[model samples]
Target: MTSARPLPQYLVSRFHGWKATTYAESSAWYRRLVDEGQRPRAMVISCCDSRVHVSSLFGADSGEFFIHRNIANLVPPHAPDGLQHGTSAAIEFAVTALKVAHLVVMGHTSCGGVAGCHAMCSGHAPQMEEQTSYVGRWMDILRPGYDRVKDLPEDQQIAALEQQAVIVSLENLMSFPFVAEAVERGTLALHGLVQDIANGSLLQLEPSGRFVEI
Candidate 1:
C-alpha cells in the first residue's frame, strides 16, 4: 500500500499567498471560470521541463490555453489500442470536445528528456533500453527525430534534435483522424515552435520547412 503525505510547507505557503493576492484579486474571474466552462482557444503541447512556462510565455490568463506536458513534448502516432494514453487522451479532448482552434507543439533547448533520448539512442545509456524503464519507452517516440539529427556535428545535434522533436510531434498530430479532419476543414491549424531557454527567443516552423525566429 502507498502512504499519503501532507503537502509540503513551501507549496502550502505559496498557495496561501496566491489565494490572498492573485486569486483574491481575480475572484470574479475565477468564479466565472467555474460557472461557465473553460473555453481555451488553443492547445499547447510542451515539454515537462519546469522552466517552460507556457502561460507566462504567451501572457495567457487562467482559462486561455489548454496545455499538455510530457517527456520531450512528444505526440505519439495515433493508436487506438485500448490503452491508457494520457497524451493522446488530452489531444482528443482538446481537439474534439473543447474544439480548440489551434494546436501548438512547443519544444525547448537544453531539454533533459531530449538529451536522454540522444544518449539512449547513442548506446551511452544502457539502462534506458531496459523494458522496465517507462521514460525510455516513452522517449522511443522521438527515435525518428534522433535519426534525423544523428549525422550532425556533435555540437549541433542537440539543438537540431530539439527542433526535430517539435517537427515530429507536428507530424504525429496529423496522424490523428480528428486532427487531420479539423485541419482539412480549416477549423484547426497546427504550429511547431522551439524556445531558446537561455535567451527567451522563439523559433517558429514555417511552411518552407524551416525554423525561423519569431
Candidate 2:
C-alpha cells in the first residue's frame, strides 16, 4: 500500500472527535480501567458482522464484558491438537483466567457467514468445496445445525440457521472441559441469543430448545 492511499479522512476525523469528547470526559474512568486490569463478568462470543454490537445493545461500559467476534461466532469442539486455536484460546482465558461468570453466544439475522454455510451445505456454492477455502472449513462447524433445520421452508431456514449458530457455539463451548467444570461448580452460566438486524429485537434460547423474544 502506498502512503498516498492513507487512512480515510472521515474515520480519522471521527476518532479525533471521539478522543475530544467521550475519552476526554471519561479520562479518569479510562485511567482506572488501565490501572486495574479488566475483570469482565461475562464473555460474549458474537458474529463478526458489524450490525451486532454487544456493548451498544446492552449499554455496557468499558471493562464490563469480554467480547470475542468471529465469522458466524463459531466455537469448534475442544481440539487439543497442539495447534493454534483462536476461539478455544479465548474461551480458556475467559473461563480459567478471567473466570467470567457467564458465557453468551450471540448470533444475528442476515449473517453472510451463516448464509454462505447454508449455500455451501446445499451444494449451491462450488467454490467452497475446494480444500483451500478457509471460509468453507470454518463454516463446517455450522453444518450439523444446518442439517437439523434444512427441512424448513426457504424463508425460515436462514433464520433458523442463524439461531442454530448460537446453539452450535453454546454446544461447542461446553465441549471445553474448563467451561463445563465452571458450569458444574456454579461459577459459569451459558446463554444463547439471536438478534434481529432490522427491528432490533432480541430472542433468547430457553431450556425447552426454543428461542423466544426477550
Candidate 3:
C-alpha cells in the first residue's frame, strides 16, 4: 500500500457489452421487474465505488434500490437553481413517483469520499474554489456534517461524522418539497445508518451517541 497505483481502469472497459449481455442472461427476471413498474420498497443512498456496492451488500438484484451515488453517499438538499442535480432527481423519483416506503442513507467506514470531507474540514484537503471536478461540489453538501462531529477523537471521528452525515442527509431530503410532503403525509419513512464494513455491524443513532444495533 506504500506506492499507490490506479486500478486496472480497462478492466471495466472490457465489459462495455456486459449490460446487454445481462439483459439476455436474465431476460425473464428483468422483464418481470420492469413490467412490475419498479415499485421498489427501499431506496439506498450509497457510494459510487464499485467495491462498496449496494446491490451485493443488500442482496438485491436490479430495481431493488432506486439508487443514487456520488463521491460519497451524500444527499444534497433538493436545491436546484440552474444546476443539473442527479441525486435530487433520483430522490424525486423514489420518494414521489415510486413511493418507496423507506429512504435509507447508508454510510460506511473508511470511505475515501467521507475521508475527503473530513480532510476538507480539517484543512488537510485543498480548497475547492474554482475546482471543476464534480466531487468538490458534492463534498460541499457534507461540510456541515463534518463540522457537526469534528470535535471527536480520530478513532471515532469518521464513524461519528459519517453517521451524522446520514442524519443530515435525511434532513436535507425533507427539504425537498416532494419529500416533505411525502413524509408529512406518512408516505415515506426516513432512516439513516452507518455500516461497519469491518464486522458487518449496522449501528443506528438515537438522537445522541447511543447506538442501538439493528
Q: Best candidate, TM-score-wise?
A: 1
Supply candidate 3's per-residue lDDT for 210.
62
TM-score of 1: 0.97
Which ten contiguous residues of candidate 3 have the minimum total lDDT?
127-136
- Give all TM-scores, in the order shown: 0.97, 0.96, 0.81
Model 2 clashing residue pairs (backbone): none
Q: What are the clashing pairs of model 3?
A: none
Query: In candidate 3, what are the lDDT values of residues 1-214, reduced to their tens digit?
Result: 4898756868666565666687679889888986777878899888776667778777887877788887678888867797888888888888778889998888777788777778776887676522784566678888888887878888788877777677778779879998888889997888777777888887776666565778
Q: Report model 3's TM-score to 2 decimal places.
A: 0.81
Model 2, span 4-47: residue lDDT tens: 86688999999999999999999999999989988999999998
lDDT of each: 0.96, 0.93, 0.78
Clash number for each model: 0, 0, 0
Model 3 C-alpha RMSD to native: 5.8
User: Which runs of model 3 end up more than 4 angstroms from their true locations?
Assistant: 1-26, 127-130, 207-209
Candidate order (lDDT) = 1, 2, 3
